[model samples]
Target: MPLTLPSFHSMQHQQDFFCLSPSDSTMTENDFFKIRPYHNTKKQMPVLAKSRRGMRPMRSSTTSTASQKNRKLRYYSTLPVSKPAITMNHSFHQQGPKKDFISLLPYEVASQIVSYLDLSSLCQASTVSRSWYSISRSNEIWRHLASRWSLNIPQHIYPHQLDWYHLYKQRHILNNRWENGRVATHYLMGHIDSVYCLQFDKQKIITGSRDRTIKFWDLSTYQCVQTLYGHEGSVLCLSYNDHIMVSGSSDTTLIVWNMKTLQPIMRLRGHSAGVLDVCFDDRFIISCSKDKTIRIWDINNGRLLRTIFAHQGPVNAIQLQGNKLVSASGDALIKMWDIMTGECLHKYAGHTRGLACVRYDGTKIVSGSNDKTIKVWDAESGYCLMSCEGHTDLVRTLSFDKDRIVSASYDQSIRVWDIKTGACLLNFQSGHTSWVFDVHFDSTRIVSASQDQRVLVMDFTTGLDTQFL
Candidate 1:
């Protein structure tokens, strides 16, 4: 039998009597009767616990405190608490919203996707939203995109105009402006026309020009060593053996020059019209002429060995790779000839316009044409491997390196392109102010000649370099 506290019914009667009494300790067990009853909404209200001091005060819900006053202060100190756990019923009623589709992608990943699109598509995609706008504005992305569209941009874009046609003029330092450049000692000039062709040995530069002359320049002094004069008209084409220089003149003659003395060794004449192009490998000199025939000559004796009459129109260019001779003609055909027997091995006819020039870089024969395109052909089979088209004007001349092919056009620009992918690597336009008549590359540098009456040299030792003819 536990002793029971005063009943609430008995305490209610005392509270009415207590209202007339005002003494501090005058109230009996009915003192608490005036207080309101607890409610569920007031779960944090003060609670009383039985103790030695009769009815003790409330304590905070922590183990650190004992006094009610200290506990009350501690509760107020922690004004903010972790959120209560969500009830199962509430969680089941709601689901998280799906993220925006674009927001799910990373910025680099978006840019990579944009890169796969063409220029027109890229421009449109950039305007789709602000995030895409940011990706489009990146210089790396735009620069790469520009390169893919056209190889004419400077390798490093500047704040100024970086278009392809204007790049050469801005970059090339003329003889009058050589002092303003970094390496002034390394430069050359000689031809009245742009130096269309260049061949380098250990010590000299042998150049041919539309001015109908071949010049030997001393590399150390950058001065004309000797001028070999024999061709009656513009020396439109040139080739070299280890010891001799062969030039094809528009005057319908091919002259072989002694490399050491720069003297005309032999003036071989057979074509009725201008001999537009010439080439030589180990044993023979091959020439193409406006006379509409391809002639193979013995280099040692300067004698015509075999003549192949394959093209109906003028043979504008010739290239010899091993025993095969490839010729591009004004008839819009490329004919492959057997060098040993002078037989027509194969004929490639696809150009709607005349082919202007051809070059053999051991592995392939690259040709340019009035059709405004360059075609790479298999030297062995005469199969057309690839055709590169972009020039607005006739592509007049072509040359190749191990990894790249270069073209000169009547459009007055020289374009460097990757051989395998047909991607453009660089565009040079500064040195020529008129139609670029011809272009060629030695093992180390690129050279171009133009009707502008000036030759231009691009030195590989410097970063994107050029010098006047």
Candidate 2:
């Protein structure tokens, strides 16, 4: 036995065989090592010069088979493919399933996240993406924020916090009203100092200013109808008697004006100090003063009926209901007096400081105090009901509508409260940039005057911005 090398010569096309070699030889077919050239038959084969024994080559065709196997392995190595890789590569060229993040989030969790953003921020965020827009436009989010913000609108919303440009653009398409809300249609602005008192009679608004003049404002034209001048000093207080407007001044005088003519018919002078407040019944006119006495006058004759020494300190406010005259004083006591006898009937004590103003709503007596509180009392019994507290400064004035209680404070704020529950419903932080002097509410709106030399008219429903003098 001998080993033979494979010949490097061309064979019949596509035909192959197998050969194995262990040793080299020169003579026998098994001992011969031949490597012949493929194109030339006369070329000598390369010889493996060594002894050969027990070695064998089956055929030269096997060399072509080895070359084919090597070529196949090189091609497969260039692109070694797996099942996942092939599927992924093919799928990338086509379409696949889309991911939905919104569907993955629960509705309750999504809603809670949206509720914390303010209204203006929520509105702007809506325009950035479709998903955000859909959530922001929903009624649940809007209603919830509205209720929370509206609870105390004046405290929550400030001018600096609003993005005016974005809000202005969205609200531009609105015609006087947008999205169930109305804009300010009227503005009244004709006061020198704070207009401490305002009385509305049908079409006209009569306002008493600290500038010592009472002005009648025409509602339709938003113009000053008439300027009635008689008070020598700041007109601190005023009251209406259907046709007559009685005003009290810091000059210790009271002037009764004919509402129709806007002319002072009578000037009654008696108080030593400033006449702080005045009120009139059908037959009598009652005036309170810093002189610490309540004066009764004959309304028909402009004659002084009696000067009752009712208070130990300055009488700050007075109100007439039926047969009783309710007065609050710097002595921090509210006293009820009989109109005819000029005798103190009952006294209420509990106010921490001086009572600044008092008013009666047929059944209850409401008083505002320098202690920054409002107290409700049973009008007939003079029993204290509740002391409502929220203001941070002195409560300056108190007024009553049908069921609502309005209070003004030196905190530069006005709060509207439910008369029954004593819960504050809304805060109006307008009128004065300084201390608010007085607040009054009619059936339609709230009116507040402040030391900042202006009066503000606010809409009751929307709790929006104010129109000021």
Tens-digit per-residue lDDT, 1-469, candidate 1: 1111121121122221111111122223222113332222322644545455665555545323336556555665566567564334332233476454554588777667666765445444444455655564445565564342223334566634443312321232121122111221133566776566666654667777777778877765668878877877877777776677888887888888886676789889898888877888768888878889888899889898888786889888887777877888888988777889888887887788999888876668888889898888887677888888777789988888666788889988778777897876566555567888777665335666677766566544233333212
Model 2 / residue 170 / CA error / Å: 26
**Candidate 2 per-residue lDDT over residues 156-200, each given as its tens digit:** 576555444223322222212221123242447778776777666
Q: What is every candidate's alpha-carbon RMSD to the true fold?
A: 28.8, 30.2
Candidate 1 residues lying further than 4 Å off, grouped into runs, are 1-188, 193-196, 380-382, 463-469
**356 in model 1: Cα distance from truth in Å?**
0.6
Cand. 2 Cα-lDDT: 0.67
lDDT at residue 406 of model 1 (Cα atoms) = 82
Indicate the residue-level lDDT of 429 in model 1: 53
